[model samples]
Target: MSNTISVTLTVNGKRQTITAASDTPLLWVLREELKLTGTKFGCGVGQCGACTVHLNGEPTQSCLHALKDVNGKTVTTIEGLSPDSSHPLQKAWLVEQVPQCGYCQSGQIMRAAGLLKQNPRPTREQIVEYMSPNICRCGTYVRIASAIERAARETGAQS
Candidate 1:
């Protein structure tokens, strides 16, 4: 018998229902079923942050989270950050030119959003430490950090 099952969840602020194996990774469901392609697929083992998404307001690796795990949960992809790329982080990213190859940026941004939510005014050290897990092969660490700082400032994040 097929193991596909019905799962309902909220993605990008919208309710959705999808059918798939219970263990199917959330990444595939987001990309293949829900059509939220902003979350990229990287190392697939969750080591890389390319598939990062906010799960119930927390940054999570979509590649590792199973479809069943996200049932009735809320997920926010890069596209949901801001409809017009107007999030402070997005604007700061543009101002600081944080992207190189641009493949890992969505994950980076999502993770940064989570960080800012926890610590709105993280210092440079904290920014680096918190963002360490998200790798950028293009070596744009400096720019990324700068953008995050700018974002924090623009968003009126308290020091």
Candidate 2:
């Protein structure tokens, strides 16, 4: 008898099906099965936000979500942020030069996008407080905050 079960997920606006152990984390499924490597794995325990992705427009730690839990749910990885890196956040990230080592950047951007979706005009303090959990070893918090603010401003203007 096989212990693996099939799960279908909507990721980055596409549907994918994979067979794996029920306990398999969404991080591995995204990276291994779907080949969406933009969502990095930092701390498997979810203390780090390297594996952040949007689940139904909410920032969620992929490392903490299991394959079974995400079945039938919509997930948006970094690739889904824009077709050509044209999302306001991506553009602002470039303008602000928010990446150093770049490992944690995708999660940072995803988390920021979620924040902006919820609160289009977050104050600097609110941005800092919400983003505090996403660890960036390169210490790019200032740049990250700047990019998020820039993106928020741009997004707000367009709305």
Candidate 3:
């Protein structure tokens, strides 16, 4: 008997059905099964935020969520953030030049997107607190914060 089970969930605004072991982590599901590789896998233990994704519109560590846990739920990877990389954060990220090595950028951007959704104009302190979980080994923290602030300012004006 196969312990694997089928799970159906919405990813990047599309419904997808996949079969895998119940205990499989969502990070693997997104990368391997769904071919959504933007959500990185920095650490399997979730200490790092490189696997962050939006689950039901909340920033969640994909490495910590199992396939069974996310069944029927909605997940948004970096690809879903914007159809043409036009999300304010994306634009600001470029203007601010947030990435160095670029490995952790997608996760960082996803986390920042969640923060903005909750608080469109977060102060530097709030941005630091909210983004503390995601690590950028390239030491681009300043640029990351700047981009978030820029995105917040730009989005706030539109709202």
Candidate 4:
């Protein structure tokens, strides 16, 4: 077994201290260690964005992130994205009825959040480009794209 390291992280605005192997992926740490299971595991290899999360306000594949390297960092999962479901993305997704299988929605929303952070007023093509990394087996691409567009519009109106 690899040597374990202790680290502290602020996830969804909560600080936690955990001991894990340096190479352990953040996905496991969040779901198994911290019990924040909103982030799903689609592909362990990072090709699928089902395990995406936010690290210091940037979207990242938690499955590809090293636990030890995230010490003292801020991590946000879908649960954090909208504890009250107030995030425009979450609200827009609901308003648009975006999820089909529901398995990939969390990752898709997180990726959409990242996209809006960079471009709050993204075009349809832009939304597709930004969200291309996340794969939805349900093929909810149309609604997903529309949901992101909706979120972008909502966010733009807020600012």
Candidate 5:
């Protein structure tokens, strides 16, 4: 009885079939298997948002998501956010210099992308509320929020 089973999912706009233990976290599958290393590993208990990715268009902690639950789902990592690092958020992050340690920036950008997908123009309060889960040891929250705001403005001017 092999615990390893084949699970197929769409990753970064590409369909992939993976074989791994059912209990293996999506984070490992993404990093070790699929070679998408932008999604970093932090707390691994879902409290820290360093491993955030878009699972079925929702920001999910990949470390907490098991391979068994991810079959047929769509995952988008920081690499998928832009092929040429041209996404509004990426440009805004550069403009705002949001990364100090650069560990949590990928997850932060992914979460902000989710927020912008749900709300194109989020207020400062909304940005804070939405992004509170991600922790930046470098204490770059202000710049993160500013980058999000800049991306929102570049994405669209909406209330």
Candidate 6:
């Protein structure tokens, strides 16, 4: 076993204290340690985006991100987006019926949140360009795009 370090990170607006090897991936910490299992494990590598989480409020691939890199930083998962699905994106997701198999919804939602934080009115092409990294096997891309558009419009209206 390698040296296990104590990393205190803020997740979903709550602080988390965990002990693990410095190289342990954040994905395992979130799911196995913290019980925030909504962040799914798809590709153990970083290409799938199924285990995406937020580091410092930016969408990040947790599978490849080391716990040490996220120490003392704010992390957000799909669960942290909103408790009651009150967030515009969540509401829009429900309204737009974005999930197909639901395996990648969490990552998709997190990525959508990041996109909304930057561009509240992204065009269709812009959304495609921005969300191209995450792959969904259920083929929910159309609904996902629509959901993002709705969330963007709602957020823009509120702002």
Candidate 6 residues lying further than 4 Å off, grouped into runs, are: none
**Tens-digit lDDT string for candidate 3 (1-159):** 338989999999999998999989999999999888999999889888999999999998999998888889999999999999999999999999889999999999999999999998899999999999998899999999999999999988997
Residue 88 in candidate 1, Cα distance off native in Å: 0.1
Q: Judge candidate 1 at residue 46 and give its lDDT.
A: 86
Look at candidate 2 and tell me the lDDT of residue 136: 97
Full-model lDDT for every candidate: 0.92, 0.92, 0.94, 0.90, 0.94, 0.90
lDDT (Cα, tens digit) per residue for candidate 6, span 35-132: 99999999889998899888998898999888778878998998888887698988998999888789999898899889888887899999999899
Deviation from native of the Cα of residue 50 in model 6, angstroms: 0.9
Candidate 1's TM-score reads 0.95
lDDT for 146 (candidate 2)? 93
Q: Which 10 successive residues of model 1 have the least lDDT summed?
A: 1-10
Alpha-carbon lDDT of model 4: 0.90
User: Per-prediction count of colliding residue pairs?
Assistant: 0, 0, 0, 0, 0, 0
Q: Is candidate 1 or candidate 6 better by lDDT?
A: 1
- Maximum-TM-score candidate: 3
At residue 84, candidate 6 shows an lDDT of 76
lDDT (10s digit) by residue, model 1, range 1-159: 337889999888899998999889999999999888989999999898999999999998899988878889999999898888899999999999889899999999999999999999999999999999898999999999999999999889533
Compose the digit string of candidate 2's lDDT tens values, residues 14-108. 88888999889999998998888999999899898999999988998999988878889999999999999999999999999889999999999
| Ten contiguous residues with the weakest lDDT in model 5 | 150-159
lDDT of 4 by residue, 98-142 (tens): 888799989999999999888888888988888889999999999
RMSD of 2: 1.5
Query: What CA root-mean-square deviation does each model show from the true structure?
Result: 1.8, 1.5, 1.3, 1.2, 1.8, 1.1
Cα lDDT tens digits, model 5, 1-159, are: 338889999999999999999989999999999889999999989998999999999998999988999999999999999899999999999999889989999999999999999999899999999999998999999999999999998778534
Scanning candidate 3 in windows of ten residues, the lowest lDDT window is: 1-10
Model 5 has a clash total of 0
Per-candidate TM-scores read 0.95, 0.96, 0.97, 0.95, 0.96, 0.95
Native-to-model Cα distance after best TM-score fit, residue 50 in candidate 4, in Å:
0.2
TM-score of predicted model 5? 0.96
